[model samples]
Target: MSFQRAQHLESINNNLLDIKGKIDVSFEFFPPNSEEMETTLWNSIERLTPLNPKFVSVTYGAGSGTRDRTHDVIKRIQKDTNLSTAAHLTCIDASKEELIQVAKDYWEHDVRHIVALRGDLPDNSAKPHMYASDLVTLLKSVADFDISVAAYPEVHPDARNAQADLINLKRKIDAGANRAITQFFFDVDSYLRFRDRCAAAGIEADIIPGILPVTNFNTLKRFAGLTNVHVPNWIHDSFQGLDNDPTTRNMVGASIAMDMVKVLSKEGVTDFHFYTLNRSELSYAICHMLGVRPTV
Candidate 1:
């Protein structure tokens, strides 16, 4: 490598070494739908548990099987390991009573933290809570559980504008959410701006930046489209012509994620939430790059 490239690598190494033990992280996962996927998910959990994530969350969707699977995974994690697990709860089609029972069941199962969400567009006949803020309120009523709600750094797709986006986030926070885990965004500046706006609006809850380690650029683009997260042209160029090279793609993914974490660390952001997408190696490597090595 050239002298300038060598210097850059040295700087990154120094940053990683300096931040040892200061970085706190959590991970997000969806419930496995198949026997094969379940094995993969457990393998991931076993690999990542040694890194000591603050919590691992299981996501719930509108489908009945998805909901059951999510609860089963959360309960299994709680029973099978020493890790703290959080359940994702959504107010999509369920009534308040049904949601209450679900929360109660989680409490009884020893899960106390919840990632409350409004879920996807509700079925036309479903009517109780309308938004995430309402879900937050319902969770608060059910129990004094540690609650987390989602925030959109680039603004939610359905939001009219940025101002309205912040307003919705504030509502969720005001409804007793302990902190907001942001939807993943590539631009660190967008996250910083959103943080500043939250402060300006007097919303003091923690806004943890969600980091997505992209294993596939195509999948990332599809998600970006649905979430209104702007995909900068540079990101496309970075992965150009590596479609057939999985190993190089993984390396690029790690490099991009490590760079993003380093920039956020310099900005004084300590906590991060990784959307693991049921794959552990990339996230495990990124956390290791951030100086969070296994203790067990």
Candidate 2:
């Protein structure tokens, strides 16, 4: 951090300190594959548990291959940790009865929260089936559970426009979603604007931006490209000379997230959800910079 950036951050830090309003945070984790991956996931969970987040979510994969693994992970987390766990439920390959059975299983296990979405088309398939009808229908069906749906700041890649996507989001919230977490996005402005547009559309559910800190620009770019998140030219310039420098790349990633959060906090948005990618160092570093310490 430069002297100028440090000074600005300190000012922001002071606001973050005496800001009275607690900055609620949550995280998203993927299901682990092997024993080694499971160990990493638990370690990451234990490391971040002391932060006392609002909730943590585990994502179900694209289809059947990983569904059982996702279920096992969610069950273990709920049983092992004190954190409120939200299981992501997608309508892609599963039929309506199968989806309900999963929800019933979650309810039986005391897992109440569900991240509902009409998931994207499965990989290499000629096209996606409209088997689930739509997210709103699914939301209505799952109204018995505390549900969270996906939001898109820049509009869904498949949506006609951002406004139209916001309408779709409003439909889900109306059907009984308690919160809406956005698809991972790089730009904070998109989230802020999306929030305003949600209010304009008279939807009042909590809209949380999914923050994805980039450790590898090459990988992040590809993920962003698929998700409709644009990598700014300035970001490219920031990482231009640091391709081979891991330490510098990490610093730049943290700085970028910090800058974006500073602007977001100014807009009265305190909640954050990091797509941790099962790594704790960068997420922990960014939280420390924001003055969110582990209070045990």
Candidate 3:
């Protein structure tokens, strides 16, 4: 009814229009644990691949237990899809020779991108290599692979402090990591501040914000605890009393994710990495909201 309100709404619409095709995004998926899950994983991949992601990464599990599964998934993606694939390589319970062999296997399969990580070490086990930085260096030495390392806006659980975490990230960059994908965080300010700190620390690699859509509040809280990411009380309050309502929960989750991306895009963040959890509905909806449509 008011001219001022009309102008405000117009500006918002124009901002959304401005973001169309101006953003780049990538998705992350975990290795499937079962045959049915494997079918689900490929279906999700096929659903999202048409969005033309920068690259899709398959996660490696803790220890060497999922090593073969991880490789099998990566190989299948590489063979079955047009999307560029990245394999998560960790130095958790493997020797340098074993790690190199895996890297070589990936190269032979034509997967060139490697998400280098210092994965969870076995209980009371000695460190195989020093850290992710070491893994980055080793990968570079083995081949000219495009490497990505993890960054934590809230600091890694094992780091002594935030500064130490940044230093570790710097080491990875200096050792030839091409990009840094951050751990998911709900508070956008945390990521903005971390981006500023990375710039101040002379880290020039593209640091993409990792976005996780929360379809389940309880599951999010548990994941946050494990990853050392803090979930604000307001988030819980927002989802409160919707315990048995899946439809409302998904609506609320989509709104939260869209709002976060809209704010980040306005703040000059053009790239995002979504932790898809091997599901496509939420992620596909979010990408569509951001104006990243299926290229097909």
The best candidate in terms of TM-score: 1
The global Cα lDDT (0 to 1) of model 3 is 0.90
TM for candidate 2 is: 0.90
Worst 10 residues of 3 by lDDT: 121-130
TM-scores, each model vs. reference:
0.96, 0.90, 0.95
Give the per-residue lDDT of model 2 (tens digit) for 1-296: 89999998788768657533456778889988889999999999998888777888898877676888888888988999899999888878877788878888888898988888777676644455542225446545754777788888988888778777877888788777888888877677778888999999999888987888788888888898888987888888888888899999999998888777767777888788888998887888888777777775
* CA lDDT, candidate 3, residue 124: 42
In the range 86-144, model 3's lDDT, one tens digit per residue, is: 89988887888998999999999999999999987676446455589999989999999
Clashes of each: 0, 0, 0
Total backbone clashes of candidate 2, pairs 3 or more residues apart or in separate chains: 0
lDDT of each: 0.91, 0.81, 0.90
Over 4 Å off in model 1, which ranges? 122-129
Q: Order of candidates by lDDT, top first?
A: 1, 3, 2
Give per-model CA RMSD: 1.6, 2.7, 1.8
lDDT winner between 2 and 3, please give it.
3
Ranking by TM-score: 1, 3, 2
What's the CA error at residue 292 for candidate 3, in Å? 0.5
